[model samples]
Target: MTILNGLKILDFCSLLPGPLATMMFADLGAEVIHIESNRRVDLMRIMPPYDEEKESYIHQHLNRSKKSLQLNLKSEEGIEIVKKLVKDYDIIIEGFRPGVMKRLGIDYDTLREINPRLIYCAITGYGQTGPYATRPGHDNNYLSVGGVLNHSRLKDKKPVAMGIQIADIAGGTMHAAIGILAAALHREKSGEGKFIDVSMTDAMFAMNALYGTQYLGSGRPPQPEEEILNGGTFYDYYRTKDGRYFSVGSLEPQFRKLLCEALEIPELIDSTFNDSSYTQQRFKEAVTDAFCTKTFDQWLEIFNEDFHGCVEPVLTFDEACNHPQIQARNMLVDVKKSDGSTQRQIGTALKISGVEPTYQYVGAKMGAHTEEILKTYGYNQKEIEKLKANGVLI
Candidate 1:
């Protein structure tokens, strides 16, 4: 059985973070009912990484293993239908801005009246409370406000956007999922529901915890490209012989010695180069020269012979899929499509002993389960037809 086999989740979220969070739950076997809008499909349906036969990879990845029901929350009858479902669900996740859900009359307070045991998680860019809570912002704005951008800026260069939506995924969606899980467990013991207010900005601040701690303690500001982990030649990326790259994190003396020995650089044997100024110049040049002498394959071979934990070859998406270590860890899984085709998909990163994770369905079509959901909510055939005709359900 899946971990969340008996749990019912009402996923009233969209975009990346909230959907991905609840998708993870659905993947683990939760009965997640994705409450979409008949007025508009989720933006991901038309976004990038689309497949010719199916929807975009964003929709495929985030909506897999769940059921969808398109219902317009703007209509009175539609809100009533959602209220009925709330009575049966254990958790509800909404990613709308603050006051939007309440305006629809399906907010936590209204639902708590029907089912006090429900765990309601509200995920937003700045949270439900704060001066910027009402402001419309995206992942970029959240990261900027939460000080995450400071860590990502290049030396003397403007801060660049990250490859992934760290604020959305890491901060908002992930924390909302965790909060819901925690609230669910607590409700099991307390017989009371709870509200989880997750802010993307607040969540992103966690990325700078260690630096924040040091900054607070030493009265030193966290400068761009200067922190030990963020900067320093010992723990950074370097281009290799073929213009490909590898990363080294030989922060400790022993690991640094291993790196120097592997590259046959005796000049870096002393601690003088350990200084920030000297290390940034001499160590980077030395490492760059050594890497330039050999191809990425040759460097990989050298690292394979050594047992140090500080060195690793940087991998592209394709390379990462076929990497021996990743393959051994079962990080990638082959998913069979309905048309007798297959695609390589990422598997769950969590590895719990004695508990296997499973995904039994691909992403379904929009509003694929509208009739079924209405029936489950006690709506008869004729009543559902009326709602469908009125544009409440499609």
Candidate 2:
């Protein structure tokens, strides 16, 4: 059986973080029902690069293996429908700003009265009670305030905007999933559920473990390009003759010696441990010049010959998607859609023996399963039609 078989989830989340967190559970065979609204469908459903017969690529990718129920939660009948479903769901994840759920009278305190065993997870920007908790913010703003953007700069340039949503995905999505799993385990033991307050900004601070630890112990904040791992030394990216970049991470003394020997620059071995900025700059320039003399492919061949140093080429997106290692590990799979077509999507990273998780299907259309879901809640056809006529079910 699948790992999450028989588990039920009600997802009142939209956008990236909360949807992604619940999608993980759905991937593991949990029955996830997304509470959507026809009047306010998820923005991802309309994002660009849509298939001719399906929703946007973002929705198809992130909402796979989950069902959708379009119900206007603002309506009293809609809220009542959710309360009835809460009694049977094991978890509920919501991404609304603080107090929104409470305003609708469906917050954790209200839902727990219906089902004390329900695990309610709230993902907010700041938190449920912080001064900036109610303030609206996005991934970049959260990263900026959490001290991540400060150290993520070059020698003199400002912090670069990341292509990936680090604060949203890594901070909110991952931490919320972890909290839900931990709470579920706790319920298994104590026979009681708990509320989880996941703050994206607070979670992003944990990513500063190394630099934060150093500053806390020594009271000296890390400057950009002042540490070995943070572009401070020769252990950084270099441009090849083809203008492609290669990553060199020879941090250990032995690995550094190996890289220096491989480059035929044995004199630079002593400078590896030097902390002087001027010396490090000269060392980095020397390595850059050396790497530029060879094409990326040539250097890759040389590194593969005998070097055990952590030196490799920086691959492009297409290269990475079709890389031999990724293919061997089955990191990508084809997900079927309702239109009898398939899309390539990334597969689960977890690889448990005898429990292989497979992609079932892409996201369904809005309200695709509303009637089916309501039937499970004991709503007959007449009741469902009456609710629809009253502008409750979409």
Candidate 3:
């Protein structure tokens, strides 16, 4: 059996974080019913980069292995319907502002009255009670407040923006998933549910454990390019002759010595341990000059031929998508749509020993299972039709 075979989830979230958390559960075999609004469609459904048949690629990828139910939560009848359905679902995840769910009368306090065992998760940019709880922000803002962007700069340059939404995925999505699962485990013993407040800013702060610890213990905050891991040492990226980038991470002494030997710069071997800024600058310049002499492919060949350092060519998105190691790890999967067409997607990263995750299909259309879900909640055909006529369901 799958890991979460009998679990049920009601996901009332849009964009990235909450949907991604519940999508992970759906991949692990949970029955995830995505509660969307007929009045306001999900933003992802209209984002760029359509599929071959002009379907929303974001929707297809993020909402795979889940069902959709479009209902207007503003209507009283719609809120009643959700109240009835919450009695049966094990988890509820929402990504609205701090007081929005309470205003809609569907907050954790209200839902726990109907089903005390409901695991309610709230994902927001800030937490529920902080001064910035109600503030509007995104991934970059959270990263800025959490000290990630500050240490991410290159010497005197502006803080570099990351290609991926690190705060949304790593901070919000990952932490929410972990919190919900932990609450589920606790519920198994206590026979009670819990509320999880996942703040993207808070999660980023938690993930900065290493830097935080250093600062707290030494009473000194890490500056840009001052720490070894943060481009302070030779463990950094260098440009090749072909304008491509290669990464070198010879952090240990033996590996640094091996790397220096391979580069035929034995004089720089002892400089790796010197904390002098001048020595570091000279070593980095020498390494940079050496790398500029070879093309990326040539450097890759040399590294593959028994180089003892942790060096590799920086891969593009397409290259990483088609990489042999990633493919071997089952990081890519194909899901067939209702139209009998298949689309490629990034698969689940989790790999349990005996339980294999399943990708049954791509995302369904908006309101694709609305009538069916209503029927399961004891609404007859005529009542469902009446609700649809009243703009409760569409």
- Give TM per candidate: 0.94, 0.96, 0.97
Query: How high a TM-score does candidate 2 get?
Result: 0.96
**Residues 1-394, candidate 2, lDDT per residue (tens digit)?**
5898877899999999999988888888888999999687788888888888756988998899999899999999999989999888869999999999999999999999999898999999998996898999999999998898877788888898888899999999999999999999999999799999999999988788999899999999988877767788887889999999989998788888888888888998887546578888887888989998999889988988366888988998899998888999998989999878898998888787778685789888888899998998788999999998999987
What would the per-residue lDDT of candidate 1 be over residues 294-369, giving only the tens digit for each residue? 9998888898934675898888889988888889899876665556666667877777776677765567778888
**What stretches of model 1 exceed 4 Å from their correct place?**
272-276, 305-307, 336-342
In model 3, state the lDDT of residue 278. Answer: 86
Separately for all candidates shown, the number of backbone clashes (residues 3 or more apart, or on different chains) is 0, 0, 0
Each model's lDDT comes to 0.82, 0.88, 0.89
Residue 212 CA displacement from its true place in model 3, Å = 1.8
- Candidates 2 and 3 compared by lDDT, better number: 3
Q: State the lDDT at 285 in candidate 1.
A: 79
Give candidate 3 regions above 4 Å deviation.
305-308
Q: Which candidate leads in lDDT? A: 3
In order of TM-score, best first, we have 3, 2, 1
Error of 3 at 352 (Å): 0.6
Answer with 1 or 3, whichever has the higher lDDT: 3
* True-structure Cα RMSD, model 2: 1.5
